[model samples]
Target: MTRFRAAPVLRALVTLAVLGSVAACGTGTDAVVQGGTFDFVTPGGKTEIFYDPPSERGTIGNISGPDLMVDGKTTSLSDFAGQPVVVNLWGQWCGPCRGEADDLETVYENTKDLGVAFLGINVKDPQQDKAQDFVTDNNVSYPSVYDPAMRTLTALGGKFPTSVIPSTLVLDREHRVAAVFLKALLAEDLQPVVERVAREQ
Candidate 1:
């Protein structure tokens, strides 16, 4: 397994973003309501997330997306059809996503020899360049599809839901989802699942 580290530039950018968000809060001079809690409303009411952590299972139809970049080539989900694949949904701005990157990369490295293909789906974010840089910096050697418009996510019935970062779906050789990991993955935590899927092929 490879040990992954975040680039200094990415760390700085994340720190700045956090600071900016914190600085935007109201100051002492601002008018404060008495004894009333602030209520936050989502644009479309409460989002129904498709992923359930307890079940650890989800089935999605054949989902596809446009090529982003991987190993310097453009590719799509359809290319891996007929092969068992581990699809990871992630974003550069997400802390959990960063934590799971190395685990995913390790899975890719270990399972490729066993005929398992790893695919990445990048979610929409304000910083596309930084997202690409994150992939490059980590030396991720798997294909990643761009989801700037979240087309693939929408196709998977994930729109209007506050989808968390670092969700992963495992598809069997026939392209049917076998399992869904709804949280950040660690290399040790994923080994059994990887082995099971790889052996199924």
Candidate 2:
């Protein structure tokens, strides 16, 4: 299996420049090389690229069953509806998720006031309590929804299936998927998406 990795800064810079030119030309719904290939509406009102990640795309809907506990209370994805929500599926055992934990916490702090809610769905972790402890130890303020059986994970079509950590889905106010990130996210990388959703209302 070939693992997909994010490009380095220099390569991404070149790709972004090319993508910008393509966007400026007013091409509709065309693929452009930008950092990574992505399907997006360019500033010129054209679809710049079509993002097709075998690991990221999946169906969207309400995830329910056994309640997920945050500080020992039942929780569901619906609780965060009527607002844009960022759902991060992760586990303590995943190294990449740990690498991105601090960044995610920062994202929660920065976007919480914008009416964007952040939640975690703990998946397939043998040490559930330890996973919870990781949250506490990291001082992650966002509430997490636990999925011991990986019902939610399977529902997401096993995107980022290996670690099953660091996979994040961003839902708009209507609970539609706006974006999905398969790797750890930096604050800058996530800012525009949150800002766009925040402006929806």
Candidate 3:
């Protein structure tokens, strides 16, 4: 598989953000990126819940990479097969990511008993130590795939926005996308949606 570098995409998005042309979180304006089978609903940093039935929902399939916290080891979405997963995309340098890290851990601990798993995809930060330190500092217990190149975003088949840091995706038991959050979020905002998705199937 060809690894896709994230610098170009992130740089472009950063420029847009600086220009005020890109809407940050809480803006609430809906922007849909239609590509292939998945309809990526990026609502100005808000969440987009897929109400379609499980079979009709889109899946990103299996994505794997080196384990950020464990050297010589790898992690993959398929590791949590048959279970619901909360996939978070974050970079250590991102302020929003740092702010939301604790909240993500909170939700993970709260729902792990229900067979809900949380996975973080460490992106953009090429330095492994920085990303690992962020996880350590935040007391994040969940496993993260170290993908500095953001190659896993390519696994989404061009449907997901690689530029969106602090993004979250809640997957159902079938590994289909159930909800998508394009910005930083707290446990209060994430917990309920997770519980609801966990209840399905």
Candidate 4:
């Protein structure tokens, strides 16, 4: 089996973030990458994991649903409880998001009614109109919560620290996170995990 390598999308996001941090903090490479050690061994040694949040807090996938708005309406992760929810974090300016938009939409089209839900958290995007336009251009019919303020994102970080853009979290039927992909993806990268989670009792 192929271990999931850090794809170009993940590398790009990390590079952009490092550049921004370097500009903002005037720090060297080591300074920007902070925090202490974290040890997590993926199940079966597969890098792109099938995981559950380890505790009630201080880790990824341990939080409950966040309330947000899309197209002037309100919704939350909890609303889709008892169903697998594909939560994708993206932004309009992100090249990888644009590259992966169709893949997300394709999987969404295929599995929407099979007790699966797809939600987009459009964060760090300054213009809501342009973000909506991207969805339209991609023929992505799924509703995405516009999060210019990143309120939902801030909440996510407080609960689960993997707040990288162009990331995806596959929440199992019980609303627990089943898997997380910290990179842009093809439909193939997504469908297997989604199908597996959907099969959960």
TM per candidate comes to 0.65, 0.64, 0.77, 0.66
| Candidate 4 lDDT for residue 119 | 80
Better of 3 and 4 by TM-score: 3
Full-model lDDT, candidate 1: 0.64
Instruction: Look at candidate 3 and give me any clashing residue pairs.
Output: none
* Candidate 1 segments whose C-alpha is farther than 4 A from its true place: 1-59, 70-74, 158-162
Clashes of 2: 2
Model 2 scores a C-alpha lDDT of 0.63
lDDT (10s digit) by residue, model 4, range 54-162? 2321222322222233433555555576778898888889999999999999898888878899888777767767887888788877766666556555444433444
Better of 2 and 3 by TM-score: 3
lDDT of model 3 at position 98: 90
Error of 1 at 80 (Å): 0.8
Which candidate number would show the highest TM-score if scored against the true structure? 3
Over 1-201, each residue of candidate 2 has an lDDT whose tens digit, in order, gives: 123343566678899999999877643321111122223222233221122332443335565433334443556567776888887888888788888888888887888888988878877765667877888888888777666556555444323343435777777766556676766777777767776866665
Q: Whose lDDT is greatest here?
A: 3
lDDT of 4: 0.66
Q: Rate the local accuracy (lDDT) of all candidates.
A: 0.64, 0.63, 0.80, 0.66
